[model samples]
Each structure stands twice: as structure tokens, then as C-alpha cells.
Target: MSLRLTLHRPPPGRISLAGIVPNRLAALAMADIERLPLAWGKETPALGEFFRVAGAPGPHLVFEGMDARFCDVARGMAAGECEIHGAAGDFVAADLLGGRVVVRGSVGAFAASGMRGGELHVQGDAGERLGAALPWQAAGMRGGRVIVDGSVGARCGDKMRRGEILVAGDAGDFCAARMVAGTLAVAGRVGAHAGYGMRRGTLLLLLPGAAPALVPTFVETAFAADVFLRLLRRHWLATLDAGGAFARRAGAAEWRARRWLGDLASDGRGEVIHIV
Candidate 1:
């Protein structure tokens, strides 16, 4: 029996739903859950005051009718599955350690910041810093997988340490800036400054036309890398849906790309591969 929480009225202001993940709800009774405190602006209100709780307690938790006013939807979730039927605010799955979170609509900034492990699927667009580190954090997204079906804002994977972020649509400027280690792939067009100060990581761009302009710091390479391309194709096949745009384009028989390595300012180790 899965538990469901449906918003019954508009919130007074921005609401923080931190620590309301399935792992915590699984141990609480219906009455106990309703009494849980939710951070609303300067006031703390009972969960029941805003949502109409229903269904049985279980590992599968469903949130219905969420909007931008709701933040930290599934922050620090360590286990189980969570589904958001509507749009979610910032930090949708921040610091997720294990489990899966599916958002049917768009999400605000820092969707998966500080994530250690888990899977976050956004059926719609995502805001800035999709899988990047927080302002005060040293490393972002130590491990996990994030799939954004639509476009993403700037600095998508800034300061990312370890993880995979796949975007089916366009990406904003400064994508993967200062990345330490990770794989970030974009199937559509990429904006300026794709990789600014990246130290070590792989940024794969699968655009159809001519490659977008890259910073002068990146130098082109002549390495064929057939074996690596084949392996990457296999990985994409396993990670993305077969019918998705990214998978369809990545399935090309001739997987050719132009590789550029640089961020000479940051050791010149990171690579930017542009599919031809």
C-alpha cells in the first residue's frame, strides 16, 4: 500500500518539506504524519494543514499537486521510491543517498545538488545547477544519475565530483564548469563556455549540425577512440530509454566525434566530445 499526500490548499509562502521522504514516513502512523511540522516561512505548520493525506504507509510515496512554493521535496532521501505528480521547487532530490525520485513536471534550481547515490528523473525541464555542488560545498553529486528530458539552465554540473547527468534537450551556458569528475551528455544544442575550468570529466555533445564553438583553452585531438565510443554507446543504450531522443541519436551506426581536451588553466585533463 503506497502512501499519497495531495495538496489541499495553497501554501502561505515558501514551504520546506525536508525530511519527509518515504524512509521516514514508513515508520510513522497516519496521525503521526499529519502532526509532522513543516517549515513555512517563519512559521512551522502541521503537515495536515496543507495536504490531505491518504492511502497506506509504504515505500512508495506520492506527492500530488506540488508547485514552486514547495522546496526540498525529497531532500536527503536514503531509500525507497518517491513520485511528484506536479512541478517541484528547488532541491528536489538534494543529497539523495539511495532510492529513486521521479518528477512528472519541471523542477527548480539545484535539483540534485550534493547527491551521493540514487536516480532522479525529471520528465520536464530543470533549472540551474542541475547536479552541481552547493555554494558552500566542496564537491557536488558524489554519485548518482540524473536525467532531464527537457532543457537545463546554466552551470548544469558545476563542481560535480562523480555522477552522470544526461539531458535530452538543449543546455545553457557554462555547462560543467569547474567539474572535477563525471559524465555529462547533452543530445541537443549546447550554449557558450560549455566547459570552463573542468579538471577531469567527460562532456559529450550529440548535436547534429556543426559543433558549437569551444573555448580557446581546449585543443582538438586526432585520437579515433573507436573502442571508447563503442563502450559509451553500450552504456547509453543501457541508461536511456530506447525510444528517447538521446538514445535514438546515439544509436547511429557510425559513432564519430571530434575530441577536444583542455581547460589548460585547470591541468588540461577534461575532454569535450562533439558528435559529428
Candidate 2:
């Protein structure tokens, strides 16, 4: 059902494991990639020197090694189920199109930069710019689901255009800057500029209790009585939809959701849903 792989040696320069996810390996056998593309590493002597491969029999390959030192372990990867037993380095799930990467430990900076589609779940803390766009380019996370079970550094979702990013713990400053679309949910209190300059996108906040800071430019639109929240909770949050999005209360006040339009700034139509 599962296979185990231990990496020890690597190759020279930046070796990319761009196509070694479970879904990517579905068609080919492990032996088929013994020497080629399957498990490429960087700045070492050779592939055999770094990995002590034992179980490569099935479709799933479970690697038990210090992967925190390996960058781009799953870069530009499409579909698959990658479960990292240990923490991962920067660019953990960079450019993933489809599939799921679950890190039992922490993650480095730019965790899912430019991810088109897929899901990345980090059980621990995360580094800077968790879901940010590349330097020089624009747009981050066109489509995907990124959930951090713990805390995160600054600029969690910088320039994110689409997708859903949820941080169960506190998020550093600049939670979702220049966001064009999508949703960013932070379970704990946030730092300054939580949604500063956000063109469009929904920000679901639970902490900093009372009422959120009125940016003046945003219009308060009621969402308490909206039926769409029920759909989102049952589908997106599932058991975690404790907010009013799934609440049983309904009234004019309940339907009131402050709608802030701007960061005009951009040609976007994003929504910010804050229910307290």
C-alpha cells in the first residue's frame, strides 16, 4: 500500500523533483525512474548517494529523511499525495497545479507561490510569504487550498489572486495584500494592515474580538442572512465552519456584511466576509 525511501546523496546544482508526486508516479514504476527524473536533488554528488531507496513498489512513495534540507521537493508538481513526515524547506509546494501536499511539520517561505490548483496542509508553523507571487511577476495562487494549522510569518498571502488560504493560528502583518480574488481566513488575531490595499477578496477573521477596524473606504454589506455561507461551510470548512457563515441566525443585521471595494487599484471583484 505504501513504500519507503531514504535520501542521503544528491546530484550537483539544482536538481528538480518536478514530477515525482504520487499521481505523477501512478503510471511508472519506481525502478523506471532509478536513474532519471523521478527523484532529483541538488548540490550533491549523485542521486544514489543521497537516497537509500527500499520500497518503491506501489504508486505511493513515502520518504523518511531530512527533506527539510531539500528545496523544490515538489516544485511545479501536478497531481499526487505527498506527505512529509518531517519539515520542509522553502518553496515547499511551489507551482503545484493539482494534488495535495501535507506537511506534518513546518514549512519554509513562499510555501505555495504561484500555485495554480491543489492543496497544501501544514500542521505546524510557516515561514514568510506563505502564498505569495514570484518577484517580478504578479498574481499568487490562481486556484488551490492552503491551510496552516499553526502560526505564519509576514505577508501570508501577498498578491494572491484566487484560491482559499486558511491559517488556524495567528498571522503576521500584511495578511492579504493586493488580493484580486479568493479568501484568507485567520483564526487568531492579526498584525497591522490585515487586509491593506486589498483590491478584492474575502477575509474571514475571528479574533481582535469586538468590531474590526473600519477602513472608511469599505461599504458594510450584511451577510448574516445570506444562504451562500451555508454552502461554503458544508463544502469548504466542513466541520470547522463555526462562524456565522453557518450560524442559524438570520435578520437584516445578519445579512449585513461590510463590502469594501477598491485597492481600484485593480480591476477585481473580491469580497471580504467578517462575521462576529
Candidate 3:
């Protein structure tokens, strides 16, 4: 059975649970798990002080009763599975290397900053910087897939080097700004300044009225996306119910698209596309 951590009471302050992923805790005894130190504001407290733990340590972990005060829910996880049954705070999957993380509720900002590899599925809305770079780093999520079933806040894939980020709902401003490489598909409306400084990547807009203010540096193009659409259908869209349906309709052989290439301000290789 998997270990479970249920909140005993509302935490006094935001708690940083960054290093408590299943891969690290699965081999520890219950006593050791409880004794692990967690940061609560400026003070440190044993994990058991805020949570009631049960079940044997294992590769699967479940967290229940999480709220906005619980931050860094799965930071630096290398492997295993983690499921959060309720809302979570900032940096939900920062620097993740491998594994699957599922959040049943909304998340705070910087949800997947600097992620290297993994699968993060958020069933609810996500805050700003969904897959953005860290303050000290130049690139964001290097590899991975982030699927958000609900809307997302600003700068969703800023400075990304590689990966795929799918937002089934609306995305805020600058959705793929300064991206070096990656694929970002948004199924709903996109806010202003989307792809403002993107250098190299594919930003797919699947719905009407989702156009961002095109950067003047970009040159409109007529490139066909036949191969790109097929790849998405075969690898990504086929896995989700709504996404699959949307992909089928949008990926039809007859479907035409409008493309724009740029950040001529930079390498001028990135593309922004809208399904027509």
C-alpha cells in the first residue's frame, strides 16, 4: 500500500514540502518519515506535526486535504507517482526529473519551472508561469509534458528549451515568450503578446479568437502542418478524451492553417500557428 499524508489542521503558514517525493521517502520507516524536517515559514517542524501519516512506504504516495499553504508539493522528484487530492501551492512540480504527478485541483504560480522530465497533469486551473524558467536560469522545462485541463495564468511556457505543454483551456499573456524549442498547444483563447520573443518552437492555437498580438518581427507563412498534426495525434492527443476529439476534428486532412515565423529579432525560426 502507498503512504498517505493527510493534513491534520490548517498550517500556520505556507509549508515547503519540496523534497518529500515518493522516490525519496518510499524506503524510509514511518518514524523516519514523520521525523523528516519541513519548513514552515522561518521555522522548521517535523512532517507529523502537520500531517497524519499512515500505510507503509511505497513508490506511490497520496496527499489529501492540501490547500494554498502547502507549497512545492513535488519539487525535484526523480521517479515514482504522487497524487494530490486537493488544491496545491506554488512550484508544484519544479525541476521534476521523472514520474507522474496528478493534481486534482488548482495550483499556484511557477507550477513546473525548470522541469527536466516527467508528466504533470493538472485537472484544474493553474496560476502564472506554468512552465517557466527559474530566476537564476536561462531556460525553462527542458523536457516533459504538462497537461492542464483548465485555464492557465500568464507566461505559460517562457524561455522553454524543450517539452510539450498542452492547455485545454485559455492561457494568459506571453504564452511562449523567449522559448528556444518546444511544442505548446492551447485549445482555447490566448491572451495578448503570446510568443513575444520566441526563438525556436511550435506554438499551436486550436480555437477561434485565440490569436495573440503577432510580433512585427514575424513573417507570415503558408507552411503546411501535416506532419506536425500527425505527430500530435499519434503521441499526445490520443491519450486524452477531450484532447483526442479536438485533435481529430482539428487534425483532419483538409484542415488548413495560418503560420507566422519569427522573433526575427532572434534566430527567426519559431512558428505560431492557428488552425483554420
Candidate 4:
């Protein structure tokens, strides 16, 4: 039987679902978490009051028709797949080290920030400063995959050390600000300040547009014998219904990872791709 948590409505105020599900990286004390303190208007309450909890602690978990009022549905998840059926608030999959987080719709701000590993695919659009470092933090998401089916606000993928982010739509300003390493693929047009202070990494453009300003050293190369592109397409396959259909038609296999090097301002080793 598939262990699923049907989230209908969330309790008032901020409720943390961090470590709510056990991951391969660590073990959870269900008894302790169940009895752990939760804030409810200055009062502590058990997690049982809000939504019904079903399923034992394991590597796999699923949420059915999760509400918009809910935030941190799968915060700090380490491994396995967590599917959110609808829209979500902030930090949808913050600090997720591994596994796949498939959101059927859009997401809030700071989505996938500080992520270490795994994939976060948003079927729709996204908010501001996506995949970027949080306040006072040195770097944003270290590694992982963040795919946005639509546009994003400013400062996306800021200070990202490694991983891959593909946006099939448009973007806001300061995109990929100060990227340390990784690949950010924009399918459509993008805002200003692309790769502003990027020290290293690749920024790919699938659409027809001019390169961002404030870039110094640069080189555009043709698609060479790069195997990583094939690897990326295969990684995005859907496992089940609804999403599975989308995956089959995602056109992910259309583009091969061609290599290009640029952002000479930082002697950046990053490569930007162009889809033919």
C-alpha cells in the first residue's frame, strides 16, 4: 500500500513539518515528535490536531491535495519522493539534501534555498530570489535540481555552488547573481543582470535574446559531445500518473548539453548553452 498523508487544512500560524518524516540521513523518534511542542497562538499543541497522520516512517511519502495555507510541507527532506498536488507557500523544499520534490503548480519565495541535493520541479511559475542564499547566509543552495515550468522573480540561483536549474519560461533581474558553480537554463527571455558576479558555472538560454549586461570575458561554443545533457533528460522522468504523462511529453530529450564557456569577469569556468 502507498503510504500517503492527505493534508486538508493546516492549523493557524506557523507550524514546522521539519523532520516530520524520517529520511535515510537520520532517524526520527515518532513518539518524541508526536509529543513535541508546536506553537498555536502562544500555546503548545500536539501535531495531531491539524491533519490526520497515516503511514510508518520510511523512505517514501506522498501528500494528496495539499492546501495553499500550508508551508514547509516537506522541509529539510533528505531522500525519497514528496509530491505536492497544488500551490505552496515559502520554503517548499528548503535544505532538501536528496530525492525528488514534484510540485504540480507554482511556489512561494525562497523556494529550494540552501538545498544540498535532490530535485525540485515546479510545474508552474515561482516567486522572488529562488534557489538563492537566505538572509545573512554566505551562499544559497549548494547542489540539487530546480526546474521551473514558467517565469521567476529577481535574483534566482544566487551564489549557487553546484547543481542544475532549468526555467522554461521568463525571469526577473539579477538572475544568477554571483553564481559560484552549477547550471541555470532559461528557456525563454530573462531579466537584466544575468550572471552578475558569477565566479563559475553555466547559464543556458533556450530562447532568442541578448546576453545580460555587466559581463566581461565570454565565449560561445557549439554543442559538443557532452553526455551530461542526456543524463539530465533521463533524470526527469515521471514515476506515476498525471506527472508521468507530463514527463513523457516534457521534451526533455530534445536538447543535448552543448558546451560553452564565459563570464570571464571571474575567470568563470561556467558554460552557457544555446538550444538549436
Candidate 1 per-residue C-alpha lDDT over 144-174 given as tens digits, one digit per residue, 9 for 90 to 100: 9998888999999999999899898999999
Superior candidate under TM-score, 3 versus 4: 3
lDDT of each: 0.90, 0.67, 0.86, 0.70
Query: In candidate 1, how many Å is residue 128 off?
Result: 0.7
Pull out the clashing pairs in model 3.
Answer: none
> Where does model 4 exceed 4 Å of error?
22-43, 55-57, 209-264
Model with the higher TM-score, candidate 1 or 4? 1
Q: Kindly report which residue pairs in candidate 4 clash with one another.
A: 133-140, 201-270
Model 4 lDDT tens row, 1-276: 234556656657666555554462135444543464554456777755655556655666666666555666567888777877777777888898888888888888888898899888888888887889987898888888888877888898988878877787887887887888887877777787677777787776666444444455656566543576666555654432334333433354476444456566775666666554
lDDT of 2 by residue, 12-32 (tens): 434445555666555656565
Model 3 residue 257 CA deviation in Å: 1.7
**Candidates sorted by lDDT, descending order?**
1, 3, 4, 2
Q: Which stretches of model 3 miss by more than 4 angstroms?
A: 209-212, 241-255
Per-model TM-score, in order, reads: 0.96, 0.79, 0.93, 0.76
The top-ranked prediction according to lDDT is: 1
Ranking by TM-score: 1, 3, 2, 4
